[model samples]
Target: MDNYGGHIGQGRARDSQARRDAVTVEIGYALCSALFLAVVVFGVVAGPALAFELSDTVQGTLVASGATLGAVLFTVRVVSVLNRFAREGDSTDGDQPSQPGRTNPDS
Candidate 1:
């Protein structure tokens, strides 16, 4: 029927759009990650040089701020990777008990 053909066409179009959107998201993520790395590298190489030109109090504050930022970023990345791994594991191992100590009631 014409309606069935139209529905199929719509589904294919949706699938194509979803793929394009996913690729765009991946590219954006890569760009942002590269930018973050560049910023961190620049901070590591230039932070001390810039701080030396400032007063002791200002230098200390800048160092503290940089350290805090680095720690927070590192923590965020670690948590994100862990969460992703957890989700992937769940998807690949359907219905299995996720926790090691938890036994399946039917077993």
Candidate 2:
């Protein structure tokens, strides 16, 4: 009984960590998207000062691409984290019916 209680505690911690990770990923995604927009604006407004032979169009495109890629990756991370948390939570909750013939001690 003591061992079972310990396992349950560990499972709860894991689920909590997953939820935190999901929220962090969401915040990161939002920050990256905002940064991408800021970069585009900076490139347009400070093009003359930057003088890197990089056209505003090219800079804008690159920034937009980076932002989009970051957003997609972050979104995937957030989804995965949330899924993990839910899976762990479900396994921890004994209210749900267990699968047939499977020895999922946590479920």
CA lDDT of each prediction against the hidden true structure: 0.62, 0.61
Q: What stretches of model 2 exceed 4 Å from their correct place?
A: 1-53, 94-107
RMSD of each: 10.4, 8.3
Candidate 1 clash pair list: none
TM-score for candidate 2: 0.39
In candidate 2 the C-alpha lDDT for residue 91 amounts to 74
In angstroms, give how far residue 30 of model 2 lies from its true place.
12
Instruction: Provide the TM-score for each candidate, comma-separated.
Output: 0.44, 0.39
RMSD of 1: 10.4
Per-residue accuracy of model 2 over 3-75 as CA lDDT, tens digit each: 4566447866765797688768766765666556555555555554456668778767666665566556556
